[model samples]
Target: MESSCPSTPRWNLDRPFLTGRFHQEIKGTSRFASDAKGCPLDSFSSGLENPIGCYDGAVQELIVIDDLLFALVGIEGRYISIKRVHGKADVFSFQVDASMDLALQEIAKRIFPLCESFLLIDEFVESGSQFKNGLVNHALAAALWALLLDYQAMVAQLEHQFRLRRLSIQGLWFCYQPMMGSMQALSTVIKKVSANNYAGSAVLNLLQSQAKAMAGDCAVRSLLEKMTHSASIAYLSILERVISWFILWI
Candidate 1:
C-alpha cells in the first residue's frame, strides 16, 4: 500500500531562511539532495529510530511562525526584526501567505497607533513645563500611563506564551483581535486630546466619556474606570477644599 501523504522534499540547510536566499534555491531544483546529510527531510523515512528529524522539521516551522508573530507585534526576535521607513509604513522582511500578511499588517496598524499615543503623552509630560506643573494634568498623565502599562503587560504575556510554544499565530491573532477595538478607541481619544492641546479636567472628562461608551467591554471599562479615579483625585481634592471654605464662611 502507498502512503497518501506526499513525500517530503529534501532541503539544503546551508543558507539561512532569514536572509530569504534559500527560496529560489529550494524552488529551482532537487539539487538539494546532493548534500544528503544536510537535508532535514532525510530521516523522515528512517522510522522510529530517528525522532530528531521530526523535531528539526517541527522547529523549523515554529521558527517561521514565531518570526511572523514577532514582526506582527513590532518586536525583535531571533529570526526577524521589523523596520519602519519614513515613506513606507512598515516593511516586512519575510514573505508569508498573502492573506496572513494582510491580516498582520492590519494588526500592526491598530497596535502602533496606541504605542505612538503613549509616547506622545510621555513626551508631553517630560518636556512641557506647563503640563508638568499642573496637578490635574500630572494625575491624568499618571493614570494614562498606568493604563498603557497594563496593555504592555498583556503583550508581554503573549510573547511569553509564544516563546513557550504554547501559542500559534492563529491563537495570537485571535487573542489580540478582540482588544483592538477598545485599544484603537483609546488611541484615538488620546491623539485627539493631544492634538487639540487639551489639559487637566478636559482630558479627564473626555476619558470618562470614552469609558462610558466602552462600558459593554468589562475589561476596558474597568481599566478606564481605574484611570478616571486616578485622574479625578486632584479635582476631588479641590472640590473638598472649596466646600470646607464655604462651610467656614457660613
Candidate 2:
C-alpha cells in the first residue's frame, strides 16, 4: 500500500526555512541528466540525506538550465532539481499533493511573517543617521524574505494549470545550487531597463510591458483596496524613514 503521507522524501520543506545540514545532504542524489536507461532509483542510493529533504541528484539537459532555475528559485529555499528525475520524456507537470502544498504554505506564513513584523512592529529601531530600517539588519530577514518570495513562486507554480503545453517553467522551487545568484540576475534586469532609451519613468512602461508578457501564461491577481492601501502605507513608511533623515539634515 502506498503511504498517503505525501512522500516528500526529497522536499521536506517542513518547518525550518533553511539549514546547513540540508545543503550537505542534498549534494548527492542522482538527477535525470541524460537519455540513459535504467531505474532512476538506483541512482539515488549512495547520496546523503538532509532534513529539508533528500535528493537523488536532480539533473538537467544543459548546465545553464540548471543554473537558470537555481537563480530563479533557490534563493528562497534549498533546492535539488534533476530535470529528468523519473525518466519521463516530458518535463514540468510535476504535481505535489494538497497536503504538501499546504505545509509549504504554512512555512511561508510562519517564517515569512518575521519580515512584516520587523517592518510594521515597534520593536525594530532606526539604524543610523541615514535612518535605515532595523529590519534589514536582522540576519534572518533577507533569508526570510527570500523564503517568502520563493514560496510564493512555488505556490504560483502550483496555482497553475499543468496542461501538457511545452513543460512550462513550473517546479522552479526544486532547482538549487549554493548561492544561485537570483538577486544578481534580477539586478541585471533592472540595470538593463534603466540603461535603455527613454529611461525616466520608462521603468513603469517597461513593467507594464513585462506584465503583459507574463499575462499570457499567468493569472493576474487583484488585491483588495484595503490591501492596496495598507501596502502603500507601508511603502510610504519605509520612504518616510529616509525622508525624515534628510529632513533632519536639512
Candidate 3:
C-alpha cells in the first residue's frame, strides 16, 4: 500500500493486523469462534478498540523457548482437525482482502518467532502430542510457507521499484531499514530452526536462499537497531490484535 504523504516512509513487509472486514467475518460466522468454549471472543477483541499498555516491569522476559511453549500449551484444548484448519488457512484465503497482501505475512511473522522459540529449547516438537503436532508444528509450517510466498513477491516488487533509479542516501535508508528488520525476524527463526534440527528445514532453507538471492550486494548485512523505531507504536497495536486472534484460533 502506498503512503498518502510523499514524505512518509513505506515498509517492504509491514506487519499485519485484522481489518474491520476480517474481524466481522470471524466474529460473525467463524466455526472456530462459535465452537470455542468458555474462551470469550471479547478477550481478544476488547483491546482492539483502544490498545495501550504501560510497562511496570511486572512481566519478566522469557529466558527460554520452553517457557514460552509452556505458556502456549496452557491454552485449553479443542480437537482441531489439522487438515481442515490448514485448508482454511491456505494461500488463497490469507490475503483477507484484495489490498492487504501483508495481512497473512504479519500473522506468520508473529507466529514464526513463537514456533522457533519453542522448537529451539524443546529441541523438537514431539511427534505424538496433539498440541505440538497438530497446532504448533503444523500451524508453524503452514505459516512459514505462506510467509515464504509473500517474501518472494516482495523481492520481485523491490527489484522492479529500485532498478529504474537509485534513491538518495536518506531515501535509501528508509527503503532498506524495513527490509533489514524483516531479515532480522527471519534470521532469528532460522537460527532456532538450525539449532533444533526442526522438521521445516526445507522451507526455512528455501526462505533463506530467497532472501540472499534478493538482497544481492545491497547493504543488508548489518542489523539496524532503529529500523523499527518509527513503527514500534503501531507494532504494539498490531501485536495486541494478534494476541486476540491467537486465543480465538488456538
Candidate 4:
C-alpha cells in the first residue's frame, strides 16, 4: 500500500522566494563587509557542524534582508500611528484617513515576503544559528508574529464570510483547525526558545516537554517538524522525529 504520510518536507521555500542564481551570486560576496566588520563577536567553529566565521554571520545576513523587513515593520507601524492620530480630526478626517489606509495597504504587500525570508533562511544560509541564541530569538519572534498576524487575518476573513452566508459554520471550523494547529506548533517551539539560558540542559528539558505536549496531535506533527528543523539547529536530531507515529495516528 502506498503510504499517505509524506516524506519529510524539505525546506522547499528556496525556489519560490530565494532564487538559486541570486543565491550563487551573493555567495562569497563582500557586500555585507561593513556590517560584518562592525560586529565584534568571536568566531564560532566546531569542525563542519557549527561554523560561523570570525564575525557576526547572522548580522551580516541580516544586513541583506532582515534590515529590510525591520524597515517595513517600522513603516507600517508609523502609518498605523498616523491613521490613529487623524482619527479625531473631524473636518478633514475622511480624506486623511482614506489616504493613510491606502498607504498602509501598500505596505501590507511586503508582509508575505518578510514572512518568507524568515521561514526559509536555511536555504540561503548553509548553517543555522546554533551558536547565536540572539539570532534564534529574533527569528522566532518575527516568524511567530507573522504567523499570528496571518491567523488573525484568516479568522477575521472567515468570520466575515460566514456572516455574509458565504461559508458554513462546519466549513469554517474545518478550515480553522489547520491554522490552529500551526499556531500551536509555533507556540510549542517558542516555549523551547524561551529557555532563560540556551544551555544543553535547557534544550534537553525543552525536548522532553515538547514530546509530552505533542503526544497525540497528528495534525501538527509535520508542521512542528518543519518549524524545529528550520529554527533549532543545535537540537535538530533531538527535535525532529520520524513521522511514522503521526502517519499511524492519522
Top-TM-score candidate index: 1
Q: Which stretches of candidate 1 lie over 4 Å from their true place?
A: 1-133, 215-219, 245-250
Clashing pairs in 4: none
Clashing pairs in 3: none
Poorest 10 consecutive residues by lDDT, candidate 1: 24-33
Query: On a 0 to 1 TM-score scale, where does candidate 4 land against the true structure?
Result: 0.31
Task: Give the TM-score (vs. native) of candidate 3.
Answer: 0.24
Task: Please give the RMSD to the true structure for each candidate, in Å.
Answer: 18.3, 17.4, 23.3, 19.8
If the candidates were sorted by their TM-score against the true structure, best first, what order would they fall in? 1, 4, 2, 3
Q: Per-residue lDDT of 76-149 in model 2, one digit per residue for the tens?
A: 22222222223322121111112222334232332222222222211111111011222222222233344446
Candidate number that wins on TM-score, 2 or 3: 2
Give each model's whole-structure lDDT. Answer: 0.51, 0.29, 0.31, 0.35
How do all models score by TM-score? Answer: 0.53, 0.25, 0.24, 0.31
- The full ranking of all candidates by lDDT, starting with the best, is 1, 4, 3, 2
Candidate 2 or 1, higher TM-score: 1
Number of clashes recorded per candidate = 0, 11, 0, 0
Off by over 4 Å in 2: 1-34, 39-41, 46-212, 217-235, 248-250
**Reference-based lDDT, residue 180, model 2:** 26
Question: lDDT score of model 3?
Answer: 0.31
